[model samples]
Target: MTTSLVRIGLATALLLGSIGAAAAHAHLKASTPAAGTTISAAPAELRLGFSEGVNLKFTGVVVTGPAGVVATSTAAMAPGDDKTLVVPVAGPLAPGAYKVEWHALATDGHKTDGSYSFTLKP
Candidate 1:
């Protein structure tokens, strides 16, 4: 009886822990022209993949490059993919280093933000 109770307690604890983890805020999982990579050609748009679905209305990214603030269109969720945020670049990016700052609101109502940098080959 005691062994059975111990097993039940462990099982309950594991279940509760997993539930808590599932509620975590969205996290950046991947990106186009990926972090710390050098690309010879400019990307017309930026694609950001998150760990979970995000609310498009509450998510965005700000890109800054060698010349300063880069122009980008309003962010949108990739069609049929709520976990990916797509932002269009207004024009070509100059050769140099660029930093992308992003903030996201998960569908679950949790918020998260982060930044990454990449270099453009001349």
Candidate 2:
């Protein structure tokens, strides 16, 4: 009976570990002009940090301001970093509420996307 219980416990532990690993998708861990910030000057670029490494080809960000869609430069991985995505503002950001929507494909082949907002002071 003791040996049987030990096997069951080991198996349960292994199963739980695998489940945790399987749930590890690239989630948005952080961002620049960070969620809900109020800034005096428009940021030249936007930066996002993820929980895992991301594929630059499959990562993107769309920003919109009070006027409408704010154009952004092509998305790229931060220099020397695989977990940070950077998008440049095409021009000076106007004062207003800006929303940034992002999508990411992690190295693990999982895709995740999310959005946040920041207020630019006049």
Candidate 3:
């Protein structure tokens, strides 16, 4: 009975391990300027890279200043690379600390959201 229980436990462990690996969700491998990086000047665009292809329409970002939201552009999909999505940040974002909140839905159907703040040096 003890040996039988041990075998069942091992099998269950293996099954769970395989399922966990297969159920892994898409990840954000890297982003230009990085998530916590601060720039002296306003960036021309916001670039985010992912581990796998994602739906750009569902990938959205909102930049908010001390006053309120600064950008109104909807989520814009990047061409050529399905794993990358970019938002065009037009005009100049005044010098100050800004908060960027973003959400992305991977092709695997998992949704993730994150927020970061950066200071605009004078």
TM-score of each: 0.82, 0.81, 0.72
Candidate 2 per-residue C-alpha lDDT over 1-122 given as tens digits, one digit per residue, 9 for 90 to 100:
69999999999999987886687678888888889889998899999999989899998988889989998888889899999998989887779999998999888778989999999999
Q: lDDT (0-100) at residue 63 of candidate 3?
A: 82
**Using TM-score as the measure, what is the rank order of every candidate, best first?**
1, 2, 3
Candidate 1, backbone clash total: 0
Model 3 C-alpha lDDT versus the unseen true structure: 0.74
User: RMSD of each candidate?
Assistant: 5.0, 4.7, 5.3
List the candidate numbers ranked by lDDT, top first.
1, 2, 3
Write candidate 3's Cα lDDT for 1-122 as tens digits.
Answer: 69999999999999987875566555677765576777787777777777767787687788887657876555566778887778777667788777778788878677877777777776
For model 3, the stretches where C-alpha displacement exceeds 4 angstroms are 1-24
Q: What lDDT would each prediction earn against the true structure?
A: 0.93, 0.89, 0.74
Evaluated at residue 97, the lDDT of candidate 2 is: 99
- Clashing residue pairs for model 3: none
Candidate 1 worst ten-residue window by lDDT: 16-25
Point out where model 2 deviates above 4 Å.
1-23
